[model samples]
Target: MSNLTDMEIFARVVSAGSMSAAGREMNLSPAVISKRIRRLEDKLGTRLLQRTTRQIAMTESGLGFYERVVAILASVEEAEAFVSRGSAQARGTLKVAAPTSFGRLHIAPHLGDFLSQNPDLSVSLDLDDGFVDIVGEGYDLAIRIAELSDSSLVARKLAPVHRILVASPAYIAKFGVPASIEDMAENHVCLAAANQDPWRLMGPEGVVTVRTGAPVKTNSSEVVRECLLAGVGIALRSTWDIGPELRDGRLRLILPQYRASKDVGLHAVYPSRRFLPAKVRVFIDYFAGLYGASPYWDTGLETWLGPVEEARAS
Candidate 1:
C-alpha cells in the first residue's frame, strides 16, 4: 500500500512536470514531496529523475516505469469506476489541443455545459492550426478533422466531416448554378485553398476529380470562406463550417449529388486506447453523444442537400 502511494506520487510528479506542482496538487509541502521521491528512488535503487534548477527530466528507466505505472493507475481507476458505476465523477485537468476555427465554433461554445456537469474537473484548451505533438507536449486529447492515415495514435470518431459543393446566393445569381460537373469545368470558378485543388468527389457516376479554374487561390481557409460569402465562386466546404450560413440562407448548396468521401471525420485523438484517463473519457463521450448520427449543425440541412451518409461512430 505504501509502495502504491509512492508510485502514485511519482506518477503525479511526472504528469504535473515538477515536484512542487505535485505537492501543491496533493496538498503537501515541497520538502515532503522531495523526501518521498528520494525514498522511492532509494527503495528501487535507481535514479528516477534528473533535477536541475530550471526543470526536471525523467531518466530512461523512469520513462519506462512511468508508462507501466500509468497503465496500472488506469486499470485501478477503471476497476473502481466499474464498482462505483453511476457515482463515479471525473476530476482532473484535461489539457486538449484543437484547430483554431473549429474550437471557436464548436468546442468553446459547449464547454460551459461540460464544466457545469463536472464541477471537479478543469480544462486547458490550446487552439492552433499546426499539428501539435500530443504526447511530447502533454496534451490529454487532440481534436482533428481528417481521413486519418497515422496508425500510431488512437482516435474516436466524434462526427462526420462532409464536404459539399456550395455557393452564395449572389454568386449563383450572377454566374448561374453549375448544371453538371462538365459545366463546372467550362463555366464556373472555385474559391478554395490553392493546395486542396483539384477537388475530389464521389459523384453519381463514381469517384472523380475536378480541377476547376480557381482565379482566387490562397492558403488561408478564412480567406476562402469570406470570398465565397462575397459571391466569388463555388467552393467545396465542410458542413460544420458553413452550417449557420446554410441554415440562414446566406450560402446555398450547388451540387447536391456530389460530396467528398465518407471516411473523413472529426476525431478525438489520444495517445493510448488502453490507458485512457477518466477526464479524457468523459470529454470524448460527451462530444460523441453531442454530435451523434445527426449533429445539431447538420439539422435542417437534409431539406437542402438531401440525405447524405454519416459516420458510423460506435
Candidate 2:
C-alpha cells in the first residue's frame, strides 16, 4: 500500500512536470513530494528521475517503471470500482476513439444518454477516420467498422456493416448503370477512399474484383459521399451512411445482385478481456444495445433492397 501510494505520487509528479506543481495539486509541500520520490527510488535501487532547478526528466529505467506503475494503478482503480460500486455504477474518464463520420452520426448523438446514466463517469471521444493505434495512443476503447484482422485486442461485434455499390439516379441516368462488374471502368467513374482497394464483389458465379480507375480519389468518406450525391461517380458506400438517401430514392443501389464481399462489421474493441474496466464494458454494452440487431439507419430499406444479411465476427 505504501509502495502504491509512492507510485501514485511519482506518476503525479511526472504528469505535473515538477515537484512544486505536484505538491500544489496534492496539497503537499515540495520537500515532502521530493522525499517520497527519493524513498521510492531508494526502495527500487535506481534513479527514477533527473531533476534540476529548471526541469525534470525520466531516466530510461524510469520510463519503463512508469509504464508498469500506470497499468498497476489503473488495475487497482478498476478493481475497487467494481467491488465497491458494482458493475452498473461505472466512473472515471474513458478515452475512446472512433471513425469521424460514423462517430459523429451515430455514437455522438447517443453519448448524452450514456453520460446521463453514469453520472460519475466522463468520456473523451477522439474521432479519426484513419486507422488508429489504440494501444499506442492509450485509448480505452475503439469503435471499428471493418473485418478485423488477427489482433491481440478483444473485439465485441456490435452490428453488421453492409456496404453496397451505389450511384445517384442522375449519375445512373447520365452514365448508364453498369451492366456488369467488368463494365464499371468503361462506363462510370469509381470514387474510392484508397486507390489500392478495388471493388471486391461477390456474385452468383463467384467473387470478381474490379478496378474502376480512380477518377476521383479522396481519403475522406464524407468527401466520397458528397461526390456521390453530386453525381460524381459510383462508389461502394456503407448502408449506415446512405440509408436515408436509399430509402428516399435519392440514391439507388447499382449492382443489386452483387454486394461488396468485404466482411466488415461494427466492433467495440478494447485492450483485454481480463479485468476489464467497468466504464469501458458498460459503454460497449450501452452502444451495442442502442444499435441492436438491425440498426435504425438500416431500417425500412429491407423492403426495397431485400433482407440484409448480417456478417458475423470470425
Please state the error at residue 295 of candidate 1 in Å: 0.6
lDDT of each: 0.82, 0.82
Q: For model 1, how does the per-residue alpha-carbon lDDT over 54-151 read when each residue is reduced to its tens digit?
A: 55799998977776676677667866875776645687688999987889999999999999988878999999877787765778789998888876
Report the C-alpha displacement of residue 114, candidate 1, in angstroms: 0.5
Local error of candidate 2 at residue 220 (angstroms): 1.0
Error of 1 at 276 (Å): 2.1
Please give the lDDT score for candidate 2: 0.82
**Compared with the true structure, what per-residue lDDT tens digits does model 2 show for residues 44-108?**
99999999986679898897787666567777888877688665467889999999999999999
Worst 10 residues of 1 by lDDT: 305-314
Candidate 1 — which residues are off by over 4 angstroms? 1-88, 212-215, 305-314
Q: Look at candidate 1 and tell me the lDDT of residue 115.
A: 95
Error of 2 at 225 (Å): 0.5
